[model samples]
Target: MTTEPSQLKFILSSVLLITCGQFHYTFLFRAI
Candidate 1:
C-alpha cells in the first residue's frame, strides 16, 4: 500500500514538471 502511494506521487510530480516547463517556455516566447 505504501508503494502504491509513492508511485502515484512520483507520476503526478513528473507530469506537473512537464506542464510547468511548457508553460514557462510559452511565457518566455511571448515575452520576447
Candidate 2:
C-alpha cells in the first residue's frame, strides 16, 4: 500500500518535471 503511493508520487513528479522542462524550453525559444 505504502509502496504503491510512493511509486505513484515518483511517476507524478517525473511527469511534472518533463512538462515544466518542455514549457521552459518553449519560453526560451520564443524569447530568443
Candidate 3:
C-alpha cells in the first residue's frame, strides 16, 4: 500500500481526535 504524507497526517489527527473524545467522555462520566 502506498500512502502520502498528507494521508499520514490525516490519520494521525483523526486518531488524536478520537483519543481526546474518549478521554473527555470518561472525565464527564466520572464528574457526573
Candidate 4:
C-alpha cells in the first residue's frame, strides 16, 4: 500500500497537535 501525500500531512499534523497539547498541559501545570 502506497502512502499518499495527504495522508502523510494528516499524520504529521496530528503528531504536531498532540505535541502542542502536551506542552500546553505541562505549561499549565507549571503555572499552577
- Measured by TM-score, the strongest candidate is 4
lDDT of 2 by residue, 1-32 (tens): 35688899999999999999999999999999
In order of appearance, the predictions have TM-scores of: 0.85, 0.88, 0.89, 0.91
Q: What value does the lDDT take at residue 23 in candidate 2? A: 100
Candidate 3: regions farther than 4 A off: none
The per-prediction tally of clashing pairs is 0, 0, 0, 0
Off by over 4 Å in 4: none
Candidate 1 vs candidate 4, lDDT winner: 4
Which clashing pairs does model 3 show?
none
Judge candidate 4 at residue 14 and give its lDDT.
100
Residue-level lDDT tens digits of model 4 in 1-32: 89999999999999999999999999999999
lDDT to native, each model: 0.95, 0.95, 1.00, 0.99
lDDT of 1 by residue, 1-32 (tens): 35688899999999999999999999999999
Ranking by TM-score: 4, 3, 2, 1
Model 4 clashing residue pairs (backbone): none
| lDDT of prediction 3 | 1.00
Model 3 Cα lDDT, one tens digit per residue, 1-32: 99999999999999999999999999999999
